[model samples]
Target: MVQFHKGFPLELGPVEAFRPNDIQHAAADFPELNFGIHHMGDPYVDETISIASRFDNIFLILPLWFNQYYLQPYKMLHRLGDALLFVGAERICYGSEAFIWPHVQTYIDTLATLQMPDELQDKWGYPEITREMRENILGKVFARGLGIDIEAKKRELAAA
Candidate 1:
C-alpha cells in the first residue's frame, strides 16, 4: 500500500505533510519499480499529476477520492477526465474504497454513464469515455501492470 498522502492533524507542525515532492526522488531513482500513488497525493493533485507526467511507471489510483467526488461531483469528474486525457487509461486504476462501498458503486455507475460533454470535448479535446477505456481503468490496466494474464487465469480457475 503506497501512502503518499495523509490526513495528518495540522496542529503541531509548521510545514505541510504528504507533499508529493518528498516522493519524487524515489520515483526518479527507481525507474524499474512501478508506483501506485495513493490519493494521488491529495491536497497536491496538480503536483502529483505533473510528476506523473514525467514518469511512465507512475500510476494514479482513483478509489480513495470517492468522498471528494461525492462532495464535488463536477470538479472531481473534470479532474478525473483531465487525468484520463493526460495519462491515458493504461495508467489509471479503480477499486473499492472499503469504507464507502455504496458511494463507490455510485462512482462506478457515474463513470459508466460518463460522456465528454460536447463543449468540453471541442474546447479541450477530451476523448469520449468509451466502455473499453472504462474497462481498462477499472481493472485491466492494473492486471497488465502486475503481469497477470486475466483471461488465462480465469480459464485455469474454470478448469480446476
Candidate 2:
C-alpha cells in the first residue's frame, strides 16, 4: 500500500477501481499510507466522503472538471458541497487536472467564481474561496495526510 500510494501520481483519474475492502486491507497493512480519492470518487461523492471519514488513511482531492456551476440546477455541486463539508477541508486537497497552462488558468478563474457560503468558506480556511485556495488544496491536506517526512518534499510543497 505504501509503495502504491507513494508511487501513484496525481495525474491518475478518480480511484473508482479501488474498492473499500481494498482500502481497508491497505490501511491494515500500512496505516501511514496516503490514499487520495479524486473527484469525490467520480460519481459517488457521498460514499467517497463517508469512506474518507471512516478511514484515516483516506483523503480527498477536489480536482477540476465540471465546476460547481456545471452541476446543473445546482444539485451536483450542492451534493458535492455537502459531502465536502462532511469530510472537512483539512482532509480535502485541490487540483485542476488541467491539460495545459491555459486550462490551468481557466480552472483558477472558475474556482474564483465559485460562490460558497460563509460556513463552508471558513471550513476551507479562507475568508472566501478563490483561486488562492488552490495551493492549500493541492498540498496542505496531502502533506498532513501522508505525514510526508522528507524535508525535500516539504520544501518543495506547501502545507495548509
Per-model C-alpha lDDT, please? Answer: 0.70, 0.55
Residue-level lDDT of model 1, residues 37-153, one tens digit each, is 666666777877777778787777776674676688667767777777788788877742424545546767766676767776777777788899889877887777666799999
Candidate 2, residues 77-131, lDDT tens digits: the string is: 5654665557666666653243344556565565556666666555653344445
Candidate 1 residue 141 Cα shift, in angstroms, is 1.8
Each model's TM-score? 0.80, 0.59
RMSD of each: 2.9, 7.1
lDDT of 1: 0.70
Most TM-score-accurate candidate: 1
